[model samples]
Target: MTQTSNISRRRRTKQAKGGADYEAKRAELLRIAAELFKEQGFQSTRLLDIAQAAGLDRATVYYYVGSKEELFHETVEGVLDANIAVAQQLIEDDSLRAIERLKKIFVSLMISYEDNYPATFVYIQEQMHQVAADETAWAQDIMKKTRQFDQILIGFIGDAIAQGDLRGDIPVRLVENALFGMLNWTHRWFVPGKGMTGQQVAESFWSIFIGGMVPARADA
Candidate 1:
């Protein structure tokens, strides 16, 4: 081959290899950036800080993520998707009763929060801030997800009520909102290995959710 032709071939090969390397490094950088974003609020975190935390040049960080806001959104969405998947799996189990399924969902959510405290904290903060800043948009988005989960819980509750397993006087929406409030609050106080396991916390929650908000029957 001519010298110029050989040089051209080497250049093409190098570009191809560099493209592959960039993708791999970009994935790693995104992971590190997510951790940093979770540690510091998205507004407080700087691109250079993320790059430094990821051990990459600032410009290279831009190659992986377009902006800090984009990175923050992606990170929060990834965690939310994973959590929805866990809930979907638990609800799909045919053998478990409605109460049992609800227990699984609560336990799994608590475990997820405990395992990913940083990501969960960031998500919660962003969601709260967004809601406070723009009530309309935030309410719509929150209601969309809330309604989706509410449908699942309502279905289970409806089945239990039909089977005489639970009280029928309570509205399904009320039940769903109450349960969501109780379960979602766990992210605030749930510390792992502080003498209570996720399952134990779940059971305590179930006791309140299943046993009714009011006093139990006297004829036990």
Candidate 2:
């Protein structure tokens, strides 16, 4: 190979390694931030805390992320968006019955929470309404997606009621709220290594919830 070509090849290799390192460090920083946010919360966790946990100084941390708010945003938003998308898609799937879709959503979400770990729990713990009130664009967007996710569940529940799958006497919004209570409350007590996995917890919750929702058939 020509000397010039050899130098170009080496330069490209160096750039690739540099990019990989940057991404790897940023990912480490995000993992640390998520753990801290889950433990200390958004207001209490500082950039310095994440930096120290990641073994990066404050200024160095900024090279990977913009600020504490941005870091928190980074830690939570992707998983939240992915969950919303999955729920939306599951509800839209014509092949699945309403109850099936809803079950998939609940189970998928629990698996996601466990898969993402502290990050999803951190988002669960955040008061997005208060965060949106501050008028931060990212916060407002998160709030918007949260509402969209809720509406998806509500709509699915309404359909199920109309189809005679779920109990019709109970209000749709109430059912939706009850489901949210079961799923979102996992943040408080659902540790991954505890006897059951996320899917197992989800299945147990589904069984209990569905028993109430499914109306009993008329006796002869």
The top-ranked prediction according to lDDT is: 2
TM-scores of all candidate predictions against the true structure = 0.70, 0.84
Our tally of clashes for model 2 stands at 0
| Most TM-score-accurate candidate | 2
**Per-residue alpha-carbon lDDT of candidate 2 for residues 1-220, written as tens digits (9 for 90 to 100):** 4764555565455546678787788788888888898788878999999999988787566566667777667767888889888987886789988878888888998999899888777766785446667677877888888789888888778888888899998989889878768987888898988889999999999999998778878981
For model 2, the stretches where C-alpha displacement exceeds 4 angstroms are 1-18
Each candidate's clash count: 0, 0
Summed over model 1, clashes come to 0
lDDT of 1 by residue, 19-107 (tens): 86766775566666657766776677898998888887765565466577666555555655676777688677888777667667767
Cα misplacement distance, residue 45 of candidate 1 (Å): 1.1
Worst 10 residues of 2 by lDDT: 6-15
Candidate 2: residue pairs that collide: none
Candidate 1 Cα deviation (angstroms), residue 129: 5.0
Error of 2 at 70 (Å): 0.8
